[model samples]
Target: MGVGGAGCSAAFAIASSQGFQVTGCDIEKTSPYLDKRLKKFVSIGHDPAHLKNSEVIAYSPAVTSFDSDNEELVMARKRGLEVLPWDLFVAKELLKNKFVIAVAGTHGKSTVTAMVGVLLEKAGIDPTCLVGAIVVDWGCNYRVGESKYFVIEADEYSEKFLNFTPNIAAITNIEFDHPEYFRDFDHLKETFKKFADKLQEDSVLIVGSDVNLKNNNGKTNKVSGPADLNLKMVGGFNQKNAAIAAAVAQELGIEKDSIKKTLESFKGVARRFEFIGEEKGVLVFDDYAHHPTAISETLRAVREKFPDKKILVVFQPHLFTRTKVLFDDFVRSFTEAPVDKIILVDIFAAREKDEAAVSSLDLTRAIVGGKAKYIPSLEGAATYLVKEVSVGDVVITMGAGDIYRLPTRLLEKLEGKG
Candidate 1:
């Protein structure tokens, strides 16, 4: 099977561990996420020409479903081989379980999905799990187990979550995104409403408590949680995510106390505002907030949590299309909680060509009333942080890229570890 993104990582782990004779492929293989599993891949370029022996083709959400000629897809179909999409595979697995907790929403899918899995395992649930991001406890994305419960990230990228009939569904805030796939916020909201329609009669749907369901100047109604879900997290948004997850866990017969304890102990997921070690006197952190909405939540959280400290951000623009599409939104997302310093790194263009004339300059130019500057590479960005950063300044390197390593490397450099 062929796949990409966090979904692909799961397929790789499963196929590799089960001795299913899987040969994965990708274009650039240097990033921490890509390079960590570099030993198990073989590919000259982005196309699936190397995996010619693949019996059936597997695709990720990043892979366009409408495109029939997506190298691996076209080749497999031409040879009369089956093409099973990742979402379909994940959905089928969830259907077999009596207690499937599906985490669905535009944002916080990875964090909430992994949090549920962690809580279940901690509570001795031994539930089979499928998360988009790699959890520290599992050290892998997908797990095959002997349990009745299953939890997976129910993504709305292509309304893929609709295929899964979850026993306990959780929606951790719905926002407008993936403009390349959807037309407008209305179209996206309608898709989410349709997903809600798929739920069984009062089977329990856990939505964010303070989530503005309808976007920009629209109907921003909030979905209240159960009495047991009355707990707080880092930010208002994260607290909502924790509440939604707790509600789902409670619906599955998990005790209210355990839910509270588990959520309180949930530190957070990697790249979702992860805390990297500090260097000298500056505190280092990282987050996987490529979209403007995510950026808003993350920056807001840091601002609220560390109000006295100076907030410094090392931002990397992911995907040329995304950066180009919401260029101004990226700037305005940080409006509410404006930081003291900003270091803009080169755009982490994944899959898409630089046709939209997108660059780091767009984000830098849009950052209003902030000390925003452009740096080309991770090394340069880290160097600038070292030279310019002062005591009590919180440094956050954010994006869906290998920017997290910068903080670690900087710390290592300071401690003579590198």
Candidate 2:
């Protein structure tokens, strides 16, 4: 099967537990960011020969990225071997056997999933967990435990999360971000409502206080009000996410003190307001905030974290479809953001082609009341930032793409190496 981010994560979850003879392959032989744990089981390139001894085949949902007709998958099909997507396989083999806690939303699903996992683990409940992003505490995207509890990040892309059967489901928040898969905002909302309906009759569903979901069958708890836990993370959004995590922990009967202690000390997942090394008094951060809402919230959080400090943003739009569809909203998002200047880089087209005729310069020109500049490459942005950034300035590299590497170059520039 395709062993990209999600697939490699599932493989690690199984391999770390020592419960299965796991094997996997990607279209490429190596990745700079490949997990060290996966080096033994996963090979760089694909060959049907790798599937020789496989009994059951599990594939990543992003199978199309490698090859729709992946040779190993086709060989499995020809041999009549058991085949399933990783999500569906997890649903059938894992979620059905455990008390599943599924975190679903347009944003913050990854963080909330990690939050709940860390809380449960800190409370001495050795729960199994799978998250979309790497939890710095685990140094991986998954944790394997013998406990009956299973926590998973429920993705809404192509309705992928509908496959899982969750006893307790949580929605961090809902918004229109995935325009490539959804027809409209209403379609996204309806899909979420359908996901909420998938819980069993007695299952519990928790929604963020700001979101309004219609769940008829399950017990729904809306998280609101101040929590006793003090989050070390910077965003107001993190506080809200903590509230949601607290609600889930309370539902599981975990002591309030344990939840508070865990949330307060949580170091956060990678690429979510992660602080890179500061150089010459200029602070740099890396974040996975591609959506307009995420960008605005992150900028506002940064402003609050370093009051009166000039914030500089370097944003790389993730996909052409998103940039094209939300062009206006993207412009408006940066208008009121707590930043002094914005650097717009070329779009990072992940699994999509540029058919919408939209470009980064178009977005840069549309932004009003902000000092926005267009820099097509991360190197260009880093070079510009080196000369412009001064003391007491916070520079952020925000996106879901290779732009994260910009900070290293920014640091080099600050050190006078670049």
Candidate 3:
């Protein structure tokens, strides 16, 4: 079984909550970022022997990165083991038994899922949660409770969420970002519509008012106003996330007082504007904002939180195909953000090989306002920031790549440890 973020979360849910013997592996088993729990059960590389006594083999998006010729999958098929994608496993094992509340969207699925989990738990419902991000409250990506409620971050990548049966579904906001999977905007929109249509006659759909879906069939309860709670996080967009979360909790008969208290006290998940530490009066925050809209919203949120602080952004593009396809949007994303400087690092090729057509320097050049620079290495970017960053600056390492580790290096360099 694969053990990426989503996959690891699912594995943890099954092992910790359901009390199953869980073993997992990734292509890079020795990776520094590999979950420590997974490292205990996972082997260094995939082998046919690993699948010898397996009952079911669950795979993550990592397996699909190879497209079709995965050897482990071939061995599983040859051995006649029950194979399922991780999301399908969630559907078969967990969602089928619980009152499923699935959150689906491009940008805010992880955050919204975590918010719902925190709110429900704080409300004493004790729901089982399978979120994409590491919930700081639980110190893991999943929480296994005895209640019949199961909250999951329903991902739309490859239409994985369509398999999950959700009695209550929430779409935070819809946009086209997964360029490799979807053909165009229309194709992505239709996929979302299909997801919305999956709601049963008695089910409810919670959506943001900004989402322009014409065929929701009046089952949706739109979140159009500010939440009644005092949000501790930054950004007006978080208010939108809170609004949708409140709507979901309200549908479940959770009291407004409890919802308000939980939403206000809920600390965010890891890597969604996670503040690492301050070095010499400079604050470093890490965020998973690879897409254009996410980048823009994150920057705006930072600006709103610290009005006088000069913000420096060090962004690593996630995939090569995403960079090549959304080149214009990427350019506009940085230009639109209210940051003082932009440091563009090399693209982190998640699954695609570099075709030499597009580079980070090209993105830096395409950006207007002359506020960006191309730093080839993460250390180089940290070194440059060490000299240039001031006392009242906020440096955010933005991307869903290995760049999350860069903030620590920057902090160390600022402390003269490098």
Candidate 4:
């Protein structure tokens, strides 16, 4: 897998559990996740030459530059070594043993996926779950289990969801995403409809109650479609996620009481509006809100949860292409929030250059209520926060990239003031 966020964690989890002889080479060698997983076998740097002896090459979605490695993977194919995408490989292997609850959506997918995994484990379900976060309960992103269920975070990138035929499927919302891969909004929704149809006949399909499903002939938020069912999970987004999971559990005859117990105990994911404990009356949070829609939804959730708190948002743009393509939406994402302050960081630029001339400053200017600026690095941003952030303030660090380090460092600095 490429040394990106979720992919890297998932690779480590899989390697730990299966005790498979694992070797990894990535452009980023010092990453803690990769360091821990491939301690003895890191090739030190990414070179396709190492792909020579590998039986198959499994890759993440952000592997655009691997055109250089095509020949190496192709040579393995010539030798009948299977080349597989990570999503498909997980789905296929997961189906072999375990009850899988595959959560799929453009955003909130990771948060909700992590939520179910944690809740189930805490309730003594003893089920194995794979999530987008490094779940503390399992000590990694992937958990080895003796149970019959395999809960997984199903990704929708490049139609990766098509690989697994799920007993349960969900659509958090149908928004236009991954402009790099998909053509238009309709095309993306149609792809989801196709995935919904692939669900088991008597199974369930959970959808965002707000979005309309035009071609979903299967179960939906309808009279006959399984809409009216009760889910114990809270928060507007989580309610939707829980509704989908509940529909699946009910279909499988899981006791409603058991499901309700699971939802109430759900603590939620690490970085999706996750509360990172309070320090000196300041509430710190981290959210994986990289996309425009995701940023909007998470801000709305925060506003709803903390109606009166002064919200200080530290946002870092994830991909340059996404920032350029969804520039207007990104501009409007914070409009609805009565934000007290905003600190914008330089674009994270994952696998894309700033050819489109989009930058965090562009977004800063477009937002009306909150003031924003382009703070370029994590250290500088954290230093700025130490001075500007006031008590009764909620410092929410938002992004999908290494922006997580900012809040962590800021917290450390704040604690030192004690």
Number of the top lDDT candidate? 2
With a 3 Å backbone cut-off (N, CA, C), the pairs that clash in candidate 4 are 98-148, 99-148, 99-149, 99-150
Worst 10 residues of 1 by lDDT: 212-221
- Which structure among the candidates has the greatest TM-score? 3
Q: RMSD per prediction, one decimal?
A: 4.8, 2.1, 2.0, 3.8
lDDT for each residue of candidate 2 in 1-418, tens digit (9 for 90 to 100): 6665653455445654656677777766354335666668787677889887888888775666536787777888899999888888778776656899999998899999999999999988999888888788987778888899999999998898898778899998999978989999999988898899888778899999777985677688988754655688987888888989889999999998788889999989989999988999999999999999999989988888888888899999998999999988898998877789999999998778777589999999999985999999999999999999888889999999889889989998899844
Model 3, span 177-252: residue lDDT tens: 7888889888988898898887655788888887765324436787887575687777777888899999999998
| RMSD of model 1 against the true structure | 4.8
lDDT tens per residue, model 4, 1-418: 5643465457545645766555665556655344364555655554557766676566665554445455545565667877677676676664575556777777667655665665566556666766777654454566666677667777666787887676666666667887766787888887887777777655556666655653244465421222232333224666666666665556555677877776665555566676776776778888778887777767777777788988888899887767777888887876665577888988887766668588888888887764776687888888888887778889999887789877778888888765
Better of 2 and 3 by TM-score: 3
Better of 1 and 2 by TM-score: 2
TM-score of each candidate structure, all chains considered together = 0.84, 0.94, 0.95, 0.84
Tell me the spans in candidate 3 whose CA falls farther than 4 Å from its real position. 29-38, 214-218
Better of 2 and 3 by lDDT: 2
* Candidate 1 residue runs with Cα over 4 Å from true position: 1-4, 14-21, 28-53, 61-72, 92-99, 200-202, 210-233, 412-418
State which candidate, 1 or 3, has the greater lDDT.
3
Ranking by lDDT: 2, 3, 1, 4
What is candidate 1's lDDT per residue for 20-80, written digit by digit as tens? Answer: 6666554444423332554456453446475466775556645553344567666667788
